[model samples]
Target: MKVLIVGGAARLGPHVIRALEGEHTLRVTDIVPVETQHEFQQVDIASPAEVHGAAEGIDAIVNCSVEREGRRRAAFDVNSRGCYNMMRAAVSHGISRVINTGPHFTIQGNTYTTFDYEINPDVPPHPSTNPYALSKGVGQEICKVFTENHDVHVLTYLFYEFRDHNNPTLRGDHPFAISWRDAAEAIRLGLEVDLATLPSRCEAFNIHADLPHQRFSNEKNKRLLGFTPQDRLEAMWQRR
Candidate 1:
């Protein structure tokens, strides 16, 4: 299958590119050009022309771009509007599936002062607290709109506690810490699943690896995509 990864030159995007490149035809794109071994394209996802151009003949798209600011304007443009542009392009070109990333901060209303709240994929999303979370919330809404209006299969994953490969300090002890490899696999799993059989109109899952204090239940992912992480941070630390 052919896949277009937006912001593919970014840190986590590179990891996802590597994981998918071996098995699928990959077209990597970013707002700015970067050196990479994969097929690269330069396109601003915020522009409909660029998105439509880049999405031509692609099978799927992974919405990985995030523009974070203290306010909602820029973030909304990139996260929400940018995602709409990509979905429009994908549908126009006959793409079948789209996988989008939503941030854990969307659950801020559930755990404002503490990080101890348990999460489940089926739980209703609470109110967003900040601009970043608001953008993600809007993005998820856009995904649903595409699915309902366009008849496109869209899956969203609430990515939590993203691990920074180059910076150990950025790694958290939270139970939602998904390994880079596992996160990539989750995308692959979501991409392969048949959406027509799903019982719901829209599907969202919490992307997390096994943690002793896991706040979110991954049962939905398992039931829908048979997705389960192959590695855990505790096991990696034990090896060290």
Candidate 2:
């Protein structure tokens, strides 16, 4: 597979790259230069023209590009419109597989619930009435439209708080954490899952560590993507 990683070389990009290494051919793109050995092209995903041009001959697109938080207009422009542009480019270029990165807030409330609960990925998002959430919500909508109207396979992974797992500490069992290894493994599943086996054309999955969260469930994602999370915060913390 010839995969193009949007926002490659960003915070999580290198982890993803390491996971996919030796398994697939790779290309990268971002507004900034990628300081890696992989081939990269300068691209701003907000521009349809830029994305489409770079999208040609690509087998899959992993959209990891995100606008900085607190920039209202920039968030909408880059996150919302950028998602639309990626799907549109995929449709035009005959690229059928896409992996889009999103946030857990798309399904869970920004304010953590006091009680433990499980949230399926299909649950309707209740975004706080804010630009960041609203923009991401709109981006999910765009992914839906593209996958339904066009013959495309889209994987939207909604990740929670992620960090390196060295000597991990728990925030009183908050139940939302994805270690770097777990995150990269989830991305690997997104890249390799068979489209014919999916329940829908466009699907979103909540990807986090295997914490016994009372508020979130990754069971559906496990069935859909064949993922079994390797990092358990408590287990790793004890080892440390």
Candidate 3:
């Protein structure tokens, strides 16, 4: 597969690149230059033209792009409009598979935060009014709509905390924390899964390591995408 990774220079992009590097040919793009062996393009995903150009000749798209802390216009441009541009490009090129990523709050917001257990990804998204969450929530909706109307099949991976697998001593308090490698693996599975196996054209999964905290469920990821976290992250919660 020839994959185009938007925002390929960002924090999570490298992990994803590493995960898919040897198995698939890659074309990485970002606003700034990226130093990599794979094909690179300077693309601001908010621009429809640039996104379309980047989508050219790629078999699939992995949208790692995001705008976390910025003004409303910038956030919407990247998170909301950027997603619209990507879907349009996919439709134009007849690309059927796309992997979209965002924070877990895009699906599970304040409404589910108060709940103690079994907060799954299938619930209605509240997203509250937080700029990042709202923008990302809108992006997910755009993907859903595109899937409904087009041949495109979108698998959205929602994540929270990310832990470096090498840092054994580091532990996060968040119930949804996952090792970087495990998160990347989830994206890989999303890309490879057979479209016919999916229950719908668009599906969302909460990507996280196996943790004792039942606040969020990874069952969908396991059953649908066949994702199994290599890093259980037990040390994070276990007492010495």
Candidate 4:
């Protein structure tokens, strides 16, 4: 498959590229230049023309773009408008599958934060007025709308904390954390899953390691995308 990765210069981009390389042809794009062996395109996803142009001849798109902090306008432009451009490009290019990524708080906001266990992705989004979470929630909604109206199928992967699998440091005991390797693997699965097997045109999955806290659930990810996170991150919870 030929894949287009938007925001390919960001933190998560390299891990995703490493996971998909050699198996699929990749066209990596970012607002800045990306030094990669695969096809590179300088794309500012906020611009529909640039996004559409970068998507040409691509079989699928993985949107790793995010604007976590900046002025409110800039945040909305990149997180919200960028997602709109991505879906529009997918529609124009006749692409059916897109893997969109964002923080898990897009779904698990203030309301759900009080709860302790089995919080699933299907719950209503609360986002709690935090600019980053709100913008990202809007982006996920855009992807959902596009899937509902078009032939596209969008798989949204929501994550929380990310740890390095090699060194495996436990910065905090956040129940919703996953190793970078595990996160990348989940994206790979999302990209390859058969659209026909999905329960809806738009589905969101919470991606994380199998932590013992039981605060969040990954059962949907396992059942649908066949994602079984390899990193248990036992050091975070276990006593030496």
Candidate 5:
């Protein structure tokens, strides 16, 4: 299986790259030059031509792209339009699967509310004032729309922050975090899962190492996608 990773030079790129290495054939693209040795394409995903050109012949694509916070126009272009262009290229090329990184803050309000129930993927994303979150939410929606119109299987992973490699403890201040290794594994599963077996062609998942607060449920990651993080933040912290 050949895979293309957009924004593959970003902070989380190397981790995803490491997880899929030797498991599949790989290609990488980003606005700037990708640092690692695998075949690299300097691409601006918001540009349809560049995305289509980069996507040619790829079986799968994992979008690790995100614009820096507070840059409103850049964020919309990269986060929203970028997803649109990728799906356009994907559906055109007959690609089977696409994985997008949607921000966990898409439903920013859910995190602060005192709801007795845990937040799950089924919870609608509450409108957010934060530019970054709003843009990413739009991106996820675009993925869903494309999936509805095309034969592709789209999976969006709402991520919070990457945790420390050696110490993946749940800090009291932070309710969500995923170790780099776990984050990578999740993408691997997202790419391999068969859409025919799923209830829908499009789905979004919350990605994080298990937290004791139970603020978010990752049951879908385990049951639907076959991903179960090895490190539980609470368990790792208790040993210390």
Candidate 6:
């Protein structure tokens, strides 16, 4: 399969890139290029003109861009409207799937709220009242709308705390923790699944590692995608 990863130059992007490498033909696009090896295309996803231009020959698109700090509008623009733009382009390009990266807080409470909660794809969203969290929640809904109304295949992965790539560590016992490797595997499996039986023509899954205390449930994802992540926090810690 040919995969296109948008905002592929960011911190979390490399993990997905590494996992998909050699298994699929990969194309990368971002506003800037951190390295020069991959096929880099500079694109502003918020711009319809740019998205349409870059949607050519792409089988699927993975959104990995996060907004800059203090740029709430840009955050919504890219994370929310930008997602719609991707789906629009996907339809135009006859893309098979649209894999959208979602925040763990799409299920968890906001920073101001003390309610610690876990979510399954079956459960509805209950986000803490924060702008970022709200935006992500809306982003999930946006993908759902695109799938239902447009018959597009949209897959969402709710990832919580991501570990450092270079020198990884587990600060505390957080149930929402997901290693980069595990996150990548969840995405790969989601991409590999047969989407014909999905209820909404769109699917969403909770993406996380096998932690001692799971803030979010993985039963639905496991049943649907047959994903059992190979890495664990303790093992990763021992290796470190």
Model 6, position 15, has a per-residue lDDT of 81
Residue 131 deviation, candidate 6, in Å?
Answer: 2.1
lDDT of each: 0.77, 0.82, 0.91, 0.91, 0.83, 0.74
Candidate 5 residue runs with Cα over 4 Å from true position? 107-116, 168-173, 235-240
Candidate 4, run of 10 with poorest lDDT = 164-173
On residues 147-177, what C-alpha lDDT tens digit does candidate 1 reach at each position?
Answer: 8877688777777666644444443466667
lDDT of 4 at 214: 90
lDDT of 3: 0.91
Put down candidate 3 lDDT per residue, 115-146, tens digits, no spaces. Answer: 64888888887785788999999999999999
Q: What is the Cα-based TM-score of model 4?
A: 0.97
TM-scores, in order shown?
0.88, 0.92, 0.98, 0.97, 0.92, 0.88
State residue 188's C-alpha deviation in candidate 1, in Å: 1.4
Alpha-carbon shift of residue 234 in model 6 (angstroms)? 2.4
Lowest summed lDDT across 10 adjacent residues in model 2 is found at 107-116
Error of 2 at 200 (Å): 0.6
lDDT of 5 by residue, 26-100 (tens): 898999987777899999988999999999999999999989679899999999999999999999999979998
Give the runs in model 6 whose Cα sits over 4 Å from its true position: 110-118, 164-169, 235-240
lDDT measured at residue 10 in model 4 versus the true structure, 0 to 100: 84
Cα distance off (Å), candidate 5, residue 54: 0.2
- Could you give me the TM-score of model 5 versus the true structure? 0.92
- In candidate 1, where is summed lDDT lowest over 10 consecutive residues? 163-172
TM-score of 1: 0.88
Task: Give candidate 6's whole-model lDDT.
Answer: 0.74
